[model samples]
Structures are given as C-alpha cells and as structure tokens.
Target: MTGTPLLKVRDLSVGLETGGGMRPIISDIGFDLAPREILGIIGASGAGKTVLSRALVNWIDPPLKVTSGSVVYKSQNILDLPAQKLRMLRREIAYVGANPAGALDPTLPVGQQIVEKLRAVAPEIAHEEARKRVIDLLGAVRIPSPQMRYHEYPSQFSGGMMQRALIVDALVSNPAFLVADNVTQPLDVTVAAQVLRLMRELTTRFDTAIVFISSSLPLVSDAADQILVLAEGRVVERQATKALVDTPEHPYTRELISQIPKIWTSEAVAIDLPAETRKPIISIRDATRSYRVRKRGTFASYSTVRAVRNVTFDVFPGENFGIVGESGCGKSTLMRLLSRLERPDSGQVLCDGQDITRLSGKGLLKFRRDFQLVLQDPFNSLPPRTAIGAIIEEPLKTHGIARGAELRDRVLSVMREVGLPGTLYDELPLGLSAGQRQRVNVARAMVLEPKVLIMDETLSSLDQTEQFKLLKLFEQLQAQHGLTYVYISHDLAMVRRVCNRVAVMYLGEVVEIADNSRLFFDPGHPYTKALLSAVPTLEERRYKPEECLLEGEPPSPIDLPPGCSFASRCPNAFGRCHKQSPVLTARGNKDLAACFLVENTLSHAAA
Candidate 1:
C-alpha cells in the first residue's frame, strides 16, 4: 500500500516446446508486489506456480519459454532489457528455492559461499567486510554460533540449517524484491515457522516486497498479507489472507482448504488397535546408534555422534506408529535400525520377539523382503531414465519372486492399488507429476508384499490434495495387506490423521509416547508441546512469539550434554533436567513421557 509498486507482472504466459509442439504452462498471470508487502501464491503441484516464479525473474530454463509477459521493476521492463542489463537487474531480485541441498555448493564452506555470492553482486565490497556481513546474515537467520559454523561445509548442517543458510545467501544483497518458492516445504514445522518468521521480519525491516509461493494454503495464508489462488496455470482468486481463509469464493481455493489435515482429538476419531493384533510385532529394547564424525580443526581427532540414544519403543501389528521430530532428531536413524539396514551399536531390535538386527545372508534378504522403505523426495528417489514399470518391478526381480508376464501383472496390480494409471507404466518417471511419482514409489514398495512399511517423510513434498490422496491410499493398503506402518514425519497434523500412536523425538531420543489424541491434546513433554504449537492453522499463519517458542537451536549430537537432549530448549526445564536424563515413565493412562515435570505431576496425583 505504498507510492510505487516494487514489481509488476502483466499478461505473463509460459510455454514448453516439446516433440508434440508448444503447450502453454502458465497463462496470463498478472499480479503486483508493493513495497514491504507479501503476496502469497497458493496452488497445487503442476499448477505452474514454480514456472510463474521463474518467469518473473526471467530464469525459465531450457525447453520452456515465456511467450508473453512484462516484468516491470524500477520503471523498466526487465524482459526487454539487454543480457548485461538483465543480469544487473537480477542482483536486486532474489529467489530462494525449496531444496537447500541442491541450491548449495558442497565443495565450499557455507560462509565462504555466502561471501562469494555477495561479492558477485557487489564487487566493490572488500573480503573482510563481506565476511562480517555473512556472519551478520547468519545471525539474522537465527543460526547459533555463526562464527564457528561459518567454517563448516553444507554437509555438516541439518536440513533446517541449510535452508536458513540459503535464505542468508539470498538476502546478502538486500534485494528490493524476494521470491521464496516453497522454501519451507521440506523443512520441519518448527524450522519452517522460524524461517517464515525470519523472512517476514527481514522483509519488513528492509522494506522489501516478497512473492511467497507455496502449495500449502494455510502456510501461505499465514505468511502473506494477500493470497492468490492458482489452478491449471491460471489465477483463480485473489483476496486478503483472512478473507480468503474465512470465506474462500473460488471452488479450487475451497477444495484446497478442505484437504488440509487438522489436529485430531480423542473424541474426533476412534484410535483403538484391533483386538487380535494387540501384541507388539516389532520391539526396540534400549536401542542405540552412534557415528564417528571427523573433527573440523584436527585431522586425527573424531567425535562420536549419538544419533539414536537408548531409543525404546514397540510397534503393534496393524497399527500406525508415528515418529515426529525436527531434522537430525534420529528419526531416520531409528528407521534404519528397525528395517535392519544398519545394526544398532547396542541393544536389540526384535521382530516377533526375535532379534533381526544382525541377520545376514539369506535371513537378511528375507528380512528385507518383509520390510520396505518409502523415501521423502519422490522425484529424486525414483530413477529418471527408468520406466515406471521397471522401477516397480526391480523389487520383485531382486528377490527372485516373479518374472516375465507375472512381474508386469504384479506391478500393474499394485499400481492400481495406489491409484496410478496402468497406461503410464512404460513412461519414464521424468514425465510424471510429483504425486504420480510418489504413487509409483508406493507401488514399488508394496509389490514385494512387505509386512512392515516404514515411510520416512514420504508425503511431505506433495501438495495438500496429493498428500490427502496418498494418506487414504496408505490406509487402504494397510487394511488390504495387514501392514504395520512406522510413519516418520515432522508434520504433526498429518501424523495425527494417519497414526494410532505417536512418539515425539528430540535431538536423538524419544521425549514422549502416547496415543494420537493424548499426544496432540495433552502433550506431556515441553518439546512436544512446542512442536504442536508451532503448526500453522487455517486461522493463524504465524506462530506467536510468546507461546511455546523454543528459545535456541538444539545442541549438537556429537557433543551432547549429560542431561536430557531437549533440556536446552525446554520451557519447563529444571535443575534435575539439566543434571539427569529422565527415562520414559508412565504419566497417564498408557502414555509415557521422559520429563521430570511429568513425573512430579504423576506422583502428586497418586498422593
């Protein structure tokens, strides 16, 4: 709501040139970014939100071309600018992407990379000054011990930290306009909240306009002042954030809102286990895992990172057990232990009361056939060159279970179960959409008829509608196959919808374990409470600074304190919490929490 618009887009249309001829990807998308204002773009995957963002900055790569558009900034049309001038114009317009790992340079130290980017934009700035600015930018992103972390490479940083670093890199030049394209999609809820909060603050402080593109309607609704709904590469509706959420007019917008999984309470749904399958199918008894990481300063010295520390839990047959936590919280490591991909450093992982942690040769192969893993990134997880049929058939062929016509029939059958069309079996994964690729992943895992399925953030990358469809498919598959699921995700709401029981992990240990309703409604651990509070709702887009806000980043797993892993960030942390690590103890009816406060409350109730 200012004098001059920061950026303006008019009659923008993008098209892809293929063997079949030119096909329109985005059509006549027009919008304005006013100074210090955020314009949120909400759309499902393949709706052309990403293409529209690329077109704004004139970075539409290969095979795709912007046929018609005018990006007006600083009283000039950027599309009409010369190559040299266009490059200069790009310095004042920045873009941050969703995948931090792909965006960063692994060879260079993260801080050095930031300095190099800054110098590229402003060559006049000295190296010493650029380094200082990089440190300041890192601090602004809430990265703890910026100076020390500056020397570390991208591999050392967690997913959340890397995303923040990418943000720091994007803002180094203090651009007049910023394009954040689904930047928080891959991040954990708490980290996403932190990054979004930082972005809002930095944009406001610097008086920068931003175009925030996201598939999650609630996320964009909470982060931006105005929301633009896009469907089939066209703008369907545009309105203020609150108005759009409260009374969405467009059918597409309304549908997007309806698909979001809400936090469930006990009364909302029955979360009971089947009577015959009450016995634990998979059990973890004091399981621990550690990795030796080489020290930065000393070549010979190394530190042991306790990735999974005394993690103990049970997965009942035919029940969905959810593991929720931030990045580097040992969720994936624990999955590895359960799947027998990696043996635990200590203790045992029992399958039907038999330890399978050290199973080898024929036994290991049989165990692998009984358990399968679904990874997070569907596009990357699937091979680009291979056809969908081959990818799904590989699992069956590897185990020597099927071949020839039988193999093709099995793949197609599973594909139908996951809602993938049989016609696309011969098509490569590169041509399919994100949702379809994930369906293929599900089909591939289910082809082997596994008894246990471990989904590690499998649906996090998809749009709300796609996620909803996949969640339904998961339930159907579970019922049909009698599969036990260990769902690992940072999405608390999705976990609530899909899981019967939930375990909240912090750093590298389980902080709380309870039924879905109890975990969401009456979280016993402070860390769990903070995580739930950080989730964005339809009514509220941003986390309140005062309500259960974690004060600082988690401590490094390599040099963890002797006490509780979450003690540093726990709101109710006490002297005992900092001195002694609490074990999971009964807090409520069938609920367990590793917290001194919960123990005290239980004792008081008994007294």
Candidate 2:
C-alpha cells in the first residue's frame, strides 16, 4: 500500500484446528485503512466479519488461530513483534469487541476496569492521574455522572452504558486506529445514534482511522466512508459507501440492502389500536408488577421495586405492536406479563375477551400457541447440542399438526422456508453462522404455525441483507397466514420497516402509541423525538444536533420518578411534567402520547 497505510494487510488466511485438521476461517483477504478512511466491512454472520477483525487485531483465541498473515500496523509487522511489543502497539491500535460483556470483568467496578486499561497503556502515569484519565475517558463516551457511577458493576449499567464503557476503555490509549466490531448492535436507537455521532467526532478530533465491521448494511452505509462486503470468509465486494449502496455490483450485496427495515410509506407511525374491533386480542388493565428487596438482618429489611406502575395497553389481531425504551424500562417485564409468562401482581390479562390473568396449567399451555417468542441471541437461545432439524421440530412434537414422517417433512419444509438449506438439517447450532442460527430460530418459531410471534430483537445480530430477507419473509407469512406480531426491538430503523404501529416505552409503561408514519416525521414525546432524531439516516439534512429537545438519563426504574418518566431528559418538561404523571391521552386518530408537547404541537400543526 502507498506510503504504508495506518493498518495494512496482505493475503491473510486464518484457520481453526478441528479434527486434527486446519480448517480455513478466512481466505486470502486483504484491506488497508488509511488515516482518513473509515472502512465499513459488511457481511452476514457466517461471512467471517468478526474472524477477520480478530485476525487484524491478532487476538484470535484458541482453536480458531491465524495460520499465515502479515498484519502490518503502520509499517510494523505485528506478527513479527513480541507479545510485549504487540501490547505496546495495541495501545496505539485499539480493538472494540462484539460481546461488550466479555470485554470487561463483570465483578469489577467500571472505574477500576478503565483505570487498569489506562495504566496498562500508560505505565508511566500515576494511579491518581490514571483515574482522572478514566473519568475523562468516560466523558469521552458520554457516560453521565461518571463520578457517581465509577464504582457501579457492569450489571448495574444498561446494555448501552456497558457498551459505552467498553468504548471508553478502548479509547484510553488514544490509538491511531480502532477496530469497532458490531459496536452498535447492543444499543437502542437513541444511544446507538449518539454513540456513532460521538465516535465520528472523536475520529476527527483524534485523527483515528476505524475499521467499522457490522452485520448492519444501513448502519455501515450511514456511518462508514467506504464499504467492504464479505461472504463465505472472503471479500465479495469493496468500494466507496455511496457508490456501493447506490449501485451494488454483487447480487448478494443487492439482496442485503433491500432487507433493512424502513417505513413502507416513508414515515414512522405509532401503534394504532384497530377501531373495527371493539374488544382487543389481549388487554391489560391497571397492571402493576412490583418486587420487594429484602436484605439479611434488618427490621424493615426491604424496599419495593415497582416495575409496571398501573400500566395498560391492548394488542389487536394481526397487529405488529412495538415497545421502545432504554434497558430496564420494564418493557420486557411487561412483555412477559402480557404473554402470561409471569402474572402481574394486580391486573387483568383478558385474552379473546376473557380475563385470563390467573391462567394456570392447561390454559397457559394453550396460550403458548397463540404467542411465540423469537429470541435475541440465537447462539444461547438455540440448543447448541441438538441438530438444527430436531430444533425446528421440537415445537411440532409438543403441539403440532403432523405426526412421525409427516412432521419430519414439515420440519424440512419449514427449514427451507426460513432460508436454511435442507442439507443443514444435520448441522449443530455451533457449526452454522450467526445468521444461519437465527434462521433456525425463525424456522423453529414459525414451524408450529403460531398466530402471534413475539420477536425479541431477532434481527439485532444479522447483517442488513439477512435482516431484510427475514423481514420480507415476515411480510409473506403475515399476508399468507395472517400472523400477528408483538415485535420488541431497540432498532428504530427496523421498527420503521415492519410494524404497522408502535408504542414507546420508558420505565415499564407505554409512553406513546400511534400510526408509524406520523410518529416518525412528527414525534410527540421528547423521548420519541430524541429516539427518532438519534437514528442515523442515510438521507441527509441541514440540522443542528444541539437543537434536539432531550437530555439526561431516566431515573432508576427501581425507584422511578413520581411524575413523568422522561421529565429528566425532556427540555420542554415544565412544572406539570415534573409534578404530575402524564397519562396516554388521545391527540389524533389512532394516536396517543404521554406528553404535554403533543397537545401544543398538534394544535399548531392543525393551525
């Protein structure tokens, strides 16, 4: 490469020792990241995106080892360097990993983890100096109240916060380049957007080149300057982001882009309860799920953690209703409540106009068919030991239409339907790619012919191509079988693509619900606006980020605010927002929001 690009690789090959044989992971891959270029590496899970990143970082763990490759970091051959020397170089070239949880020790306080990293990179710096640098690093990643939060364990922090902490840890070295591998996957729309914006700002300020690798095409398209598409552990296509996105030369690349969730009619709409049907499929009235904390040896010994505080919502037939919020906002808890996985402390869960709140034994088993949950992480969610074929057939065996040979044929058919080849039936979950495993997850959930599929961030781990493919499949299934969905995800972009309506959740309750188109273009709640504005759009516009009407973190869900949950983050929140909890009030046809701004905005927009 001309004048030695910051990180240069030539003819890289990585292989894993399996059955006493070296099986190739990545073959003959080569790329360069110059000082100014942020190269986006786009690929599906099996395409070896993470493997390639590991190869570049020279951090390939165990069984999967790099056999032959020359990874030159700014003219120095990192392969030739000693472990100590490589460690020194790593200080100059950081690696931000995929599993944010594994990067840090869960037991250690965040402050200590970051300080330790700083000390490792900067050995000469004193402990106190390193600690300040740690807090400064926290600020760099936009973590709030670093002083108070420095001692908190990883479990105490949100998924987005944990990721931000890891980013801060990576940036402690002030590296010349950073390898961000699926960094945006764990975050919500607002957090993901802000993190990317901060990363962009940091890259400029620090003049750091980033090798941004992700399964997301839309994110890669929006964030990266250049694009590299990988398939089957090889480079399939490489070009500038705009050129590649507009005119993708590869058929695979073309298929990948078409799958990203976008609003069908070009506007984000809120979840609108259907008017034709008076009675909803599932209804919750005054739902409240509270947990009491009791410690050993105390008179009082406990405090109550109210997860769902008088929450109420309805799900209609064939509706793709969504719940959007920060982590621990009780969205998931509420989901479990609605699905009857757990009983609400006090509320009525009416199913088909019957109060099935205390659904026990046989009744709950029947309800399971009505609602099926597609999980987030396919690796952990899928049975690793079982064959892919058997995994898909389990639901059928328990509660299915066919029997014996008929069931086997149906399983194979379902496998093909979800894009998993029939031949992959014998394959274990470990053998398949991340995307392939997720396909199996989809297949297993769909195999039983459930009426309502509860998708819990099912598309989070997939590349944009795979995501679009699955989403399109959902559309087909919905059209043909009239499958309803309770789609739960943090990716607002994807939410825009599939859902007819959405509900924004913050701290265990629905803050807003409406038609998707109106919600996107004209967000009502400050949180909704912040969330919508945070999504990194491919379409550009002249806008100032500081003009966003939101800031600050929501109070701990364990001890929530007395008034509106978003008051701390809302710029428009006055005394009313702080003093009285705003309920979801009707603002328009099939639209509602728990905010004061919508009243003013709706009136003004009408005027």
Best by lDDT: 1
Q: For model 1, how does the per-residue alpha-carbon lDDT over 399-437 read when each residue is reduced to its tens digit?
A: 999999999999999888899889989998887888898
Worst 10 residues of 2 by lDDT: 536-545
Off by over 4 Å in 1: 139-145, 264-272, 539-545
What is candidate 2's lDDT per residue for 220-277, written digit by digit as tens? 7767888999988989899889999889999888877665555424654343445775
lDDT at residue 563 of model 2 (Cα atoms): 79
In candidate 1, position 358 carries an lDDT of: 70
Q: Each model's TM-score?
A: 0.96, 0.86
Model 2 residue runs over 4 Å out of place are 1-4, 15-28, 61-69, 128-149, 155-158, 231-261, 264-275, 292-306, 396-413, 416-426, 541-546, 559-562, 601-607
